[model samples]
Target: MEYFIQQLINGLTLGGIYALIALGYTMVYGIIQLINFAHGEFFAAGGYMGVILLSFLSANGYLATYPWLCLSGAIILSMAYCSLLATGVEKIAYKPLRKSSRLSVLLSALGMSIFIQNGLMLTQGVYDKAYPTIFSQGGFDFGNIKVSYMQIVMLLITILLLILLNLLVFKTRIGKAMRATAQDKTMSSLVGIKSDRIISLTFIIGASLAAAAGIMVGMYYGSVGYTMGFVPGIKAFAAAVLGGIGNITGAMIGGFLIGMIEIFGAGYISSEYKDVFAFIILIGVLYFMPTGIMGENIDDTRV
Candidate 1:
């Protein structure tokens, strides 16, 4: 039971990160029906940005005196940076192909992914940059279970972000506009909603979430790499699909499920087969529920 609890906590932590990343996938697909293969690059960019900003703080002696403040500033700045980056990617790569075939848009997204990945490698180098040790060292003990401060922090941020997102989607006027635009772009435009703006906003929001996930992952793992986003990105995409691709709630649930499966599979079976275990579960679930665990009655257009 102690071992099970340990793995469960680990799973939730990993799941939260994946949920953050997966939300990006679901939101974008909900709005535009695009898979957005380049979305992962935003995560990578956020990790790099977080490391860069935090390192600057450390160098300037700011982090030592005000660790939490510095960390918060880094996260906000990274999210903003990624939001701007997503906007640029949307305007440059996706906007022009809005009326084009799905294949063209998909190819463009793939090209953008390659382009961004290579750009990161060129600019940040292929080496893994170590995150400054701050919260990485501390943890709390509950009986035989051990939990890190990083895990607590990560979970709080994840839950907070998720709540804020739910409120944004279900409560705000902008969110209403987004939902309307998703449901019927032409009709929404005719009804005075700007579909283009909503689409851009969707991209911005998704990128911001991915950015947060990137920072959390870096803090948890103690390092960041230029190539770090690819696998997690793919897994998050699987989570999105598993949860019903375009459904927000589904994405979150799918992410947690995938994370739990990976952790348990690693704990009981072998670490070497962790990734395979995640995919296998995804396949099994899809085989039984083609529309995903939460895909039922979810309009693809509603966020």
Candidate 2:
């Protein structure tokens, strides 16, 4: 029981990371029906940016005396860089293909993904870089179960971001515009909504979320690599599909559920094959619920 509880906590924390990335996938899909495969590269970019910023700060004496400030600075810089990258991708790679066939757009996305990955690999080299630890090292104990401060922080951040995303999607004018655009781009354009702007905004928002997840993963695991985004990106996409592609709330739920399954499967079944656990769940979910847990919003043309 104690082992189960511990694994549960671990699973939830990891799920939080997955949920953050999944939000980006679902949001972009909701708005444009494009998977934005290059998104994984954005995640990698954020991690690398954070590492570089923090490393520079540590070495230059700008943050030598203030460790906490360095950490905060790294996070801010990473988020900003990633947000810009996301917007740039929308402008350069996706915008031109917006009117093209879905297959063309998808292929373009794939090309962008490869381009970014190889670009990073060439620039940063194909080596695993060390990530700095921000949170204090300690765990709270409950009977035989233990939860780390990192886990608690991750959970809080995930919940807070989820709430913020929900508000942005459902309560704001931009949110309404996004929904309208998703439902019918032509109608949205006719109503004076700039579909292009909305699409760019969606990409920006999604990229930023993925960036945050990258930073969190770095802090949690104390390391990152150029290829770091590959597996997580795939898993997040699976989560998006499992929860219902293009559904915000569904993505969140699916991410957490996937995380839980992976962690528990590792703990109870075999740590060696933990990664396969998410795919297994994904397959299972698709087998039974093709439209995902939330079901497809057929009337909402966005997905």
Candidate 3:
């Protein structure tokens, strides 16, 4: 029982990370109908940015003196860097092909992904960067189960972000415009909503979320690599699809489910096949409930 509880806690924390990355996938797909394959590269870029920022702080002795502030600064700077990179990618690679065939856009996205990955490798070098041991010391324990303060912090951050995102999409006028554009871009444009601008904002927000997720994962693991985003990105895509691609709520549920499945399967079954559970769930979800938990259709997805 205690072991089960421990796995549950671990699952939720992992799920939160997956959920954050999945939001980027779902939001971009919901708005544009184009899967931004380069989105994962954005995650990698953010991790690298965080590493650089943290390294700078550590070199200057500020990381030791003001740990939280340094962490916050790293997150902000990394997010900003990724957001700008995504924006540029959108403007350069995707914007011109907005009216092109779906296959063309998909090819472009893949091409962009390749470019980003190689660029990161060439610039940052192919190496694993370790985070400074800022939160390595303290936590609370229960029975035979141990939980870290960082896990609690990650959980709270995920919950807060989810709530704010829900309110943003459901309450704001811009959100309504986003929904409107998602339903019918041409019609939304006719109704005086700027579809282009809405789409750009969607990319920006999604990229920012991805970057934030990248920072959290780096902090939790205490290390990151240029290739780190690929597996997690694939898992996040699976989570979005499992919950219902394009459905925000479904993506969140799917993320948690994936996280739990992976952790518990590893705990009770075999650790070597831990990564297989998320894909199995994805296949199960796809084979059984095609529309996802709450999805309507491809074109009618909400923010």
Candidate 4:
């Protein structure tokens, strides 16, 4: 039972990270049917940015003097970096292909993904970059289960960000505009909502969440690499699909479900087959309930 509880904790932590990345996928697809396959690169870039910033800080002897401050600043800068990178990618790579066929847009997204991955490889190298330890080490005991402080902090940050995001999407004028554009781009433009700007903001918001997840993953795993995002990216996309693509709440629930599946499958079954569980669920969901558990809104135009 203690071991089961331990796996549950681990699953939730992994789920939080997946949920954050899955939001980017759902939000972008909601507004524009483009999958933006390169979205995962934003996660990799943020991880690299965090490592780069921490390296510079360590070299300057500031990491030890102001660990929390430095960590906070690195996260902020990494998120900004990813957010700007996403906006630029949208304008440069996606916007031109907007009027083109879906095949063209999808191919462009795949091309961009390749381009970004290789760029990160050339710049950050293929070697794993270690995240500098700025956090004070400690753990809490729950009976026979022990959870690290990093786990607690990561969960807290995820919850806080989720709350803020919910407020932004549900309460703000921009949020309403986003919903309007997603619902009907033509009518939104008719009503004076700039679909282009809303689309850009959607990418920005998604990229920011991806960045936050990147930071958490880096801090938790103690390492980041150029290819780090690929697996998680695929799983997150599955989560988006599992939760009904284009639905924010669906993505969140899907992420947690996938995470739990992976964790429990590994713990109880075979570690080698852990990844198989998520893909199996994804296949099952696609085959059985194509609309996902949340049921997709089919009225959105693909174009």
- On TM-score, the candidate that comes out on top is 1
lDDT of 4 by residue, 1-303 (tens): 999999999999999999999999989998898887998899989999998998899999999899889888999999999999999899989999888998898899898899999999998888999987766267899899989999998889888988898888889999889998988889999999999999999999999999989988998899999998898999999998899888888888999999999999999999899989888988898888887888554664221
By lDDT, rank the candidates, best first.
Answer: 1, 4, 3, 2
Off by over 4 Å in 4: 300-303
Pick out the ten consecutive residues of candidate 1 with the lowest summed lDDT. Answer: 294-303
The residue ranges of model 2 lying beyond 4 angstroms of the native Cα positions read: 61-69, 134-136, 298-303
Task: Give a tens-digit lDDT track for model 2, residues 226-270.
Answer: 888888998898888888888999899999988998998888889
Select the stronger candidate by lDDT from 1 and 2: 1
* Model 4 CA lDDT for position 2: 98
TM-score of 2: 0.93
- Estimate candidate 3's alpha-carbon lDDT, on a 0 to 1 scale: 0.87
For residue 89, model 4's alpha carbon misses the true position, in angstroms, by 0.7
The root-mean-square deviation over C-alpha atoms between each candidate and the true structure, in angstroms, is: 1.1, 1.9, 1.3, 1.7
Please state the error at residue 128 of candidate 1 in Å.
1.0
Candidate 1 lDDT tens digits, 1-303: 999999999999999999999999989988888999999999999999999999999999999999999999999999999999999999999999999998898899999999999999999998999999986988999999999999999999999999999999989999899888878889999999989999999999999999999998998999999888899999999999999888899999999988999999999999999989999988888899887888865454566
Tell me the deviation in Å of residue 114 in model 4: 0.6
Better of 3 and 4 by lDDT: 4
* Candidate 4 clash pair list: none
